[model samples]
Target: MSSELLHDSGLIANPASTATLSDADADSLIAELALRGRAAQRVLAGMGEQVKADALRHAAAALRAAAPRVLAENARDLDKGRANGLAPAMLDRLKLDDARLDSIASALEAVANLPDPVGQVIDQRTVPTGLELSRVRVPIGLIGIIYESRPNVTADAAALCLRSGNAVLLRGGTEAVHSNHAIHAALVAGLEQAGVPADVVQLLPTQDRAAVGGMLRAAGLIDMIVPRGGKGLVARVQADARVPVLAHLDGICHTYVHSAADPVMARSVTLNAKMRRTGICGAMETLLIDASFPEASSVVAGLIDAGCELRGDARAQAIDPRIGKASAEDWDTEYLDSILSVAVVDGPEAALAHIARHSSGHTDAIITGDAAAAERFLTEVDSAIVMVNASTQFADGGEFGLGAEIGIATGRLHARGPVALEGLTTYKWQVRGTGQARA
Candidate 1:
């Protein structure tokens, strides 16, 4: 295909194209992209909600229509990843198949169908000064998303940003370079067909690591930086970014089984949480079992039987001789694999204490028949998401019914938990006053 195919506008003329640029050139390129993104953002913010929705729907259709191309490109990325000795867990995150493509398209369609959050009145009243006061939702304007190994993010993040009336600059990982190129082309084609500005969703043309630094330093141009990856990436973004960061830090998620928990639910939730696509951040890494629970031994055995490697403390090892001794570091590790850290807590207090010390504040779950215990856990666990009797795997924006997530925010700020379209927005207070001054 010709690079001129998408060259009509600044919509990533060629995503697979890269250059060995000096630091000066990279900074210049990022600044130019940011300026273009801001221009497109203004146009999108003024568009009717229905118009934006239509464009996203078109994008979804385009993605489906281009499935063959997308899948082929994904295969190329997978081959390179295998050749480079990428870890198994990361390879899974990078790989894309027909079913996953369908899911990605479906998520785009779902975001289109969601209620447009832009311009909605969050609060309204007549103030004492005779001014009509209202707080209305507005886009966060020109967001830069830095993510790794997840090609689907190229679609999901763009859809959510457009739906919320913001422009986005995507800097995807090199591991999924070919896949990102194919996906971005389809999405841009659909948006352009529906009369949206091509620059509304821009992708960096190159995969150079220096471009990431340019994005990090783009404070005025990019309103916010959202980092969606492992702890290392998030930590770097948090440390180096001049732009405000809504960080998705380590998903050191925990699942606690109280003594009153049913054996069947404990087994089922634990197995699924750890084993069902363990590469995701929401996958449970720590299992806190109440020592007094009658089926504690069975729970540990079941995990090991399912090929999950368990690292546990002395007490946990007592439950199962097969369990390996957990190092102190194991308590805080975010193992995005079929490995788990287990702790045998004497009671709810012990479990809570362990979670408090080690939890990454992503998502924590409690399994119990006792309402009091469940309620207390919900109240006390200060993570972005707290669950009751559900797999931590369900800690997803799509699962929570917002179509798809831009990212799961582990921070305690404007956008926490599963960051969907609504989370991509902030609010501005509007006051309608007629010749009314301050008293």
Candidate 2:
């Protein structure tokens, strides 16, 4: 598409000349964008549910229609990433194919189909002094999302925010700049088609890291910030952002095999959890085995047979001669690769302690048939998602039936796990009084 087309679609302001701009210039640009975002948010918050949902549906269709251009832009980013010597795992997250594009489009449609959270009554009550009161969902105003590599997030974040009656400002990683711009253009087209202000979703024009600092400092303009990437990016946003943040921390997830775990089930779940697309945040990084479990050796061998490199403690090493010795750091690492850390614990309590000490509080799973043990693990793990007899890989927004996720939050308070439509909202008190003055 031409520059004029993009501008008309409200995807860009002036796509002309800015190859060398100073940090101050980038900050000025971000500030300008934030002002536009705030204005758009006011318009969005008042929109009817059908209007927002229609916008999301149009955006989904636009993605399918613009697939060729989006793929062409993605190829440029992929070529650049390879040239930069990006790791295989990072490349997996960066790459986008036709099927993945279709999936992204489907996710948008699903979000559109979900019930709109805006203006929904959360609770209702009648006061003793005859006053009607209610808590109702409301938009969170403008949201700033800083993510890495995943160009799909550009679409997902925009759809979720728009459907929840919030405006969004997206800042994707430099590696996926071309892909982000292309996808964003399509989304803006959809918004315009549905009569929604295209400014409801904006992408930072430049890939300069300084723009991140600008967003972090936009305390008054942006309501909340979401950082969706590795530990370094999340740590920086959590530490420096002046605005309230919905932080997505490390996914040092674990899968524990209790003594009552069936060997066949344990083996199957562990393999799928660790090997099914290891690049995602939900991929299991550590494996905990009950020391007295008879099938520990079998489960360990199953993972090794599935092409996973095992770094094990002394007890686990004793079970398998080929298992490499795990360093102290292995337990706490989020290896978004084909690596797994193995440890042997006494039982449920020991497993819980190990996880409590090393877990990133993201997602953890237990493979056991015992009801009491499963309940204890579920209750005591202290992670955002605790699965029973299931693969940790199932720790996804789609799997949880939220359609798509901005990111998996490991933080306490506000939001935890997959942050979808409801997670993007805050509430307000709505009271109806018949001109009665309180004493």
Q: In candidate 2, where is summed lDDT lowest over 10 consecutive residues?
A: 9-18
TM-score of each: 0.96, 0.95
Candidate 2: where are CA atoms >4 Å away?
Answer: 1-23
TM-score result, candidate 1: 0.96
Best by TM-score: 1
Each model's C-alpha lDDT?
0.91, 0.89
* lDDT for each residue of candidate 1 in 1-439, tens digit (9 for 90 to 100): 1235335433354565555556766677788889999999999978998899999999999999999999999999999999999999999999888899999999898999999999899989997788899999999999999999899999999999999999999999989989998999999999999999999999888877778888999889999999888778888999999999998888899999999999999999999999988889999999999988999988888889999999999988999889999999999998899999999898989998999999999999999999999999999999999999999999999889888998888888888999998899999999898998674
RMSD of each: 2.9, 3.2
Expressed as tens digits, the lDDT of each residue in 1-439 for candidate 2 is 2335335534455322234445665566667888888898898877899999899899999999999999999998899999999888999999999999999999999999999989899999999878899999998899999999999999999999999999999998888888999999999999899999988999987665767888898888889999989889998998988999999888899999999999999999999999988999999999999987899888988889888999999999999998999999999899999999999999988999999899999999999989999988888889999999999989899999998888888889888999999999999998898988988
